[model samples]
Target chain A: DAGVTQSPTHLIKTRGQQVTLRCSPKSGHDTVSWYQQALGQGPQFIFQYYEEEERQRGNFPDRFSGHQFPNYSSELNVNALLLGDSALYLCASSWGAGTNTEAFFGQGTRLTVV
Target chain B: GENVGLHLPTLSVQEGDNSIINCAYSNSASDYFIWYKQESGKGPQFIIDIRSNMDKRQGQRVTVLLNKTVKHLSLQIAATQPGDSAVYFCAENPNNQAGTALIFGKGTTLSVSS
Candidate 1:
């Protein structure tokens, strides 16, 4: 009954550093997606992974990347992090690719770029 | 986490009152819509969702109404509680292989005072 799980609940990094955040999707879920939420705004989609391949991506730059393992776990990597990249990073998992599948989210990793 | 702004339009309602949070989606082709409630330091939680073919979907104490013609979506909470206070977001997706990304709108902060 475990929901999605993410690692490093909070992180502190400096400008130009790199960070990798991990996520384990819920049991029986096959798709994982990542999002970034800035203060006072809704989450902006980062990308989605399915079948161990990235299937969809948002408007973020190439410096932001992700990977999905065979077990449906995911990792979000941000290179040369900027202060603007500092935000709450969220991982969500859903069961199917079809419509009406509900997505469950984990407690996000808060990245603070100093 | 809830988005905060000195000027963020907030709906302050008594604990026992019903609450309605509204969102206007931009994509007319969006086939799936979801409502998520995000509390401080946590990721967005799925509250409810509706597909384009349906006008309404109801959960335990929540309901989602979608008006495709108007490109509007709403979440209705019955007898809102302090635990219900959070930033509510509306996310839309076309539900297709080519457009599986969920685009989110800026959320509205809902405050319920007991």
Candidate 2:
């Protein structure tokens, strides 16, 4: 089965620009989560969408938001981006939103803020 | 393959040797732990996972050990090969978070030399 997929393998945007990244969950999966990975760090949780609603969020600010479609595809939107917002955006999908569920990840969208 | 981190904690191991990557999680209530391998340019791939109820779990060429006593988790790769060179990360699912997001550790880079 096709695994999780993300759009725009790489993106470049200037400060204050708004960018949108898209993700398709793995076949048969329902829950989608977004993560931000800096150059030397592990992926940090951004937020998670389940049943088309944002169920949980990390310490990120209002500038970072997301939407999940009925088909299980999701979008991560960053408004008024800053240089610090540059990172690899990873999308992970799982069969359910539960502690025991394992997640499958997408290749990720590399966002470069100039 | 994935892009290499700007600076990684590298583990240089000889072929056929065993390599271990360790991670310490902050949430004591984390119920699931996972190990992911990310090659240069690609997304993180699931290696193995272990649940809180179990102290250890084994996969084809990898084993995951969870030490709840110390909130520590580790990934052990057997008979390390050059193809096994990649960054390994451990992720934990904190308890009762509606998002079911994973908190990741700073990754450990593994370099297998033949």
Candidate 3:
């Protein structure tokens, strides 16, 4: 079975521009979460989606938003990107929205804000 | 405020030597903890996890120890190899509820020299 997959492995965006990253969760998984990782740092949570609804969000601003499709795929949108927004966007998938469940991560989409 | 931090930023060990990485978390309500390893140009990969109820959990060659009393967590790698060179992060679910986002540490870089 294929694992979690993310689109546009690498991307470049200018300041004040918008960018959209896509993610296809692992087979048989339902929950999707997004994270941002700067160079040489661990990932910081962005938000999580379950059952086509956003269930949890991190400290990110309104500029960061996400959507989950019925097929468990997800999309992360960042509006008005800034230089600090340049980082690796990681998508994680879990079997269920349950405590102690394992979340598998995708290779991530590298976004460069110019 | 919730935060997870590592005791060390970098660790170098000779091949076949065991390695230990430590992390401290600020959220007392966190119940689930996970360890992830990420290589250059890649996303975090789950190594092992332990819940607050359990003090220790062993996997193939890795062990995760969780001390809820002190809000501390640790990962032990047996007979480390060159392939094990990567950045290690400890993540915790701040809230015990399902669908909550995970708080990750800055990460500890492990370099296993052959």
Best candidate according to DockQ: 3
In terms of docking quality, how is candidate 2 classified?
medium
lDDT of 2 by residue, A3-101 (tens): 999999999999999999999999999999999999877898999999999999988999999999999999999999999999999999998786458
**Count of backbone clashes for each model?**
0, 8, 0
Say which candidate scores most in TM-score: 3
Candidate 1 ranges with C-alpha deviation above 4 Å: A98-100, B1-8
Q: Model 2 Cα displacement at A103 (Å)?
A: 0.4
Q: Looking at candidate 2, what is the lDDT of residue B10? A: 82
lDDT of 2 by residue, B1-97 (tens): 2211212378999999998887777677778878899998888999998889999889998998988897778788999999999988888777765
Error of 1 at A112 (Å): 0.8
Return the lDDT, model 1, position B108.
81
Name the 10 consecutive residues with the lowest summed lDDT in model 3 chain B: B94-103
lDDT for model 3, on a 0 to 1 scale? Answer: 0.92
Q: Largest lDDT belongs to which candidate?
A: 3
Instruction: Flag clash pairs in model 1.
Output: none
DockQ, all candidates in order: 0.59, 0.71, 0.74
How would you encode candidate 3's per-residue C-alpha lDDT over B1-114 as one tens digit per residue? Answer: 439999999999999999999999998988888999999988889999888889999998899988888888999999999999999999988764757588898999999999
